[model samples]
Target: METSLLAFLLISLAKVIVVVVILLMAVAYTVLLERKLVGRIQNRWGPSRVGPFGLLQPLMDGAKLFLKEDLIPEAVYRPLYILAPIIALGCALMSIAVVPFGADIRWKGVDLFEIADVNIGLLIILGITSVGVYGIALSGWSSNNKYSLLGALRASAQVISYELALGLSLVGVVLRSGSLRLRDIVDVQSTHGLLSWNFFGGFQFVAFLIYLMAAYAETNRAPFDLPEAESELTAGYHTEYSSMKFAMFFMAEYGNMITVGCVATLLFFGGWTSPFGNLFPEPHNAILLSFLSLFWFVAKVFCFLFLYIWVRGTLPRFRYDQLMGFGWKFLIPVAVANIVVTSFFIGLRLPLH
Candidate 1:
């Protein structure tokens, strides 16, 4: 028994380390992807001098940030200011623990693609994301700068307002799947290929739309990025943060972006499942199947990330009042309506008692 327990612990620790490393690498490349794409949108070359077509730019950027001087203002509250970015980045990475990236294959009697496959995986992600707000709020409050405080206030309000819509958007998926376990949710969608996906067959496309908008706001991306609106907040909540501390906030944002994409793929798209359904034969080889599953999952997530960048380059940021009004008067109501309609359809499809 002791031997088994020790093996489990060792495997779990290994999985955690691997996931965190991969996630950080993904976050770095995602920044590079955004910059390259955004540069093309403006007809300019970005990071070209750093490496051949800037392929090595993320590595250089990481080295630069690491070498930069750390700075802390004298007026700020020492403890919370120091703690804020760690909290933000920590929470962002924590949400991924329950996210499954590939097939349900096991090695050494442990999950090959996930860390901590909890029954309430969906709830756990939501809870961790909610807690991440504290990092931004604390950073703002502790900074002792009006711009920082204002940015933090905006972040807090924006998150509070949109988080409701975000959570509501997932209700239809949860109801349709009848399980909070992410693997179970994926299993339900795997039966019919693209049509079985929540975005299509399950008729949760409305929920998916809500999830997208709310996710953008939650992650402070693009038009909804009021907290860090460059024209207004002068770098916003992290304005007072510098060096590695600032890098933490930057990494946390991208990490959250990746997490959101993962959830979207799992809930709306048929995660790790081919869009063509069972049109193709299933391979008997477990190793080959695992690689194929990982490919599909990564492909879907890449598409989602591309969409995120497209929106960032194309859309204009919303004014503060407009942002608030849209969340409360538009998104929240639409999300609620989507939930009700989904529930009604789900009820109709239920077998009589």
Candidate 2:
């Protein structure tokens, strides 16, 4: 018993470390990717001087941030100010733990590629994302500057407003799959062709669209990114943060984007199920199949991230009132209606993919 427990703990530790490292690197490169993509969109060179087409730009940025002065303005709520970024970053990173990267591949009794396979994985994901709002809200409030406070309030309000639509959008998916466990949702589409994906012919396309919009809002991405509107609140909640503290919030934002993309990929894009499932069934060599699954999973995630960066380049930010109105009035109602319609048809046993 002790040996089994020890193995579990060690494995858990390793997974945590691996996930954190990969996530941070992904966030860094995502920044680099956005700059390159956005620059290409605007027909200008972006960060070419850093290194080899600016591949080392993120590293240079990180070094600059670390070498900069760490400032804490007087009159701020000292403790919470310090704690807010940590909380934001912690919540962002923790949410990734519940996401199933690929189908569970066990070799001689030990699973690989996922940290937790909780029964209520969906609920845990929602809960963690909801708590992330507190990090931004508290940071804004504790900054003791009105601009920071205003930015935090606006950003938190935007997140809160859209969160309802986000959860409701997923309800249709949950109903269709008949499970809150993400792996089970993936299982529903496993072995089927491309249309088997919820985004295509599964009739959850509406939910997917709503979820996509709400996710952008939830992660404070463009068009929905009124939280940090430079024309309004400067840098929003992290306006007062500097050096590594500011980087923490920056990392949190990108981390949230990664989590959002991962959730979307898992929910609507069939997780790690290959598009060529007919050629490569799950029963084949466990090791080789697992690697294939990993490739497919990463490819889907990269596509989602690319879409995110693409949207940032193409769209203009929504005004504050327009952002709230769209979320609360249109997005929420559409999401709730989708849930009802989905539940009704699903309950009747319609032959949905």
Candidate 3:
């Protein structure tokens, strides 16, 4: 028993280390991705001189941020100012703990894809993500700058306004799956392949659309990035931050973007499952099967990320009032209606005794 417990501890620790390192690296490169894509949208080359095709740009950027001087303004609130970015980035990283990236395959008595298989994984993600807003709110107040305060306020308000819709949008998925465990949700859709998927088979496309829009505001990307509107608020909440401190907020945004994509893939896109369903024979080799699952998961996530970049490059930023109105008056109602319609259909499909 003692040996079993020790093995579990070691495996868990290893998973944490591996996932964190990979997530941080992904966050860095996502920044480079945004720059390259956006630059091309404007007919310009981005970071071409850094390395072949600017592949090494993220490495150079990370080094520059690390070597830059860390500065704390004399007038700023010291404690919260330092803690804010930590909270932001930490929450962003923490929410990924419950997300499964592949099938429930085990190796040496350890889950090969996920860190934790908590039953309430969906709720945990929602709770952690909701708490992340505090970091933005506190950063603005602590910075002793009007622009920062305004930016933080916008973020706080924007999150509060849109989060209701985001949470409601998932109700359709939860109702369809009849389980909060993300793996259970995926398994439910796996039985019939593509036709059984939530977006198509479960008829939850409305929910998917709602979730996608709310996710944009939740992650503070372009069009919904009112909190960091440089035209009006300069550098926004991170205006007073420099060096690695500033980099933390930058990383947090991209990290949240990745997390959002993962959730969307799991909930609406039949995560890690092939669209062809049972058309292909399952590979007998466990390692081969796991690799295929990972490939599909990564490909779906990349599509979501590309959509994010495409929208950012093509759209204009929303005015603050328009942002608020769109969330409150538009998304919320549509999300609620989607839930009602889904519940009706689900109820009809249940066999009455």
| Residue-pair clashes per candidate | 0, 0, 0
> How much is the lDDT of residue 335 in candidate 2?
93
Q: Whole-model lDDT, candidate 2?
A: 0.87
Model 3 clash pairs?
none
> Over the stretch 160-215, how does candidate 2's per-residue lDDT look in tens digits?
88889999999988887889988999988775747788887468889999999999
Candidate no. 3 TM-score: 0.98
What residue runs in model 1 are displaced by over 4 Å at the alpha carbon? 1-3
In order, the Cα lDDT scores of the candidates are 0.94, 0.87, 0.93
TM-score of each: 0.98, 0.96, 0.98
- Over 231-294, each residue of candidate 3 has an lDDT whose tens digit, in order, gives 9999898899999999999899999999999999999989998888989888889989999999
Better of 1 and 2 by TM-score: 1
Clashes of 3: 0
Candidate 1 residue-wise lDDT, 145-258, digit = tens: 999999999999999999999999999999999999999999999987999999999989889999999999999999788899888889999999888999999999999999
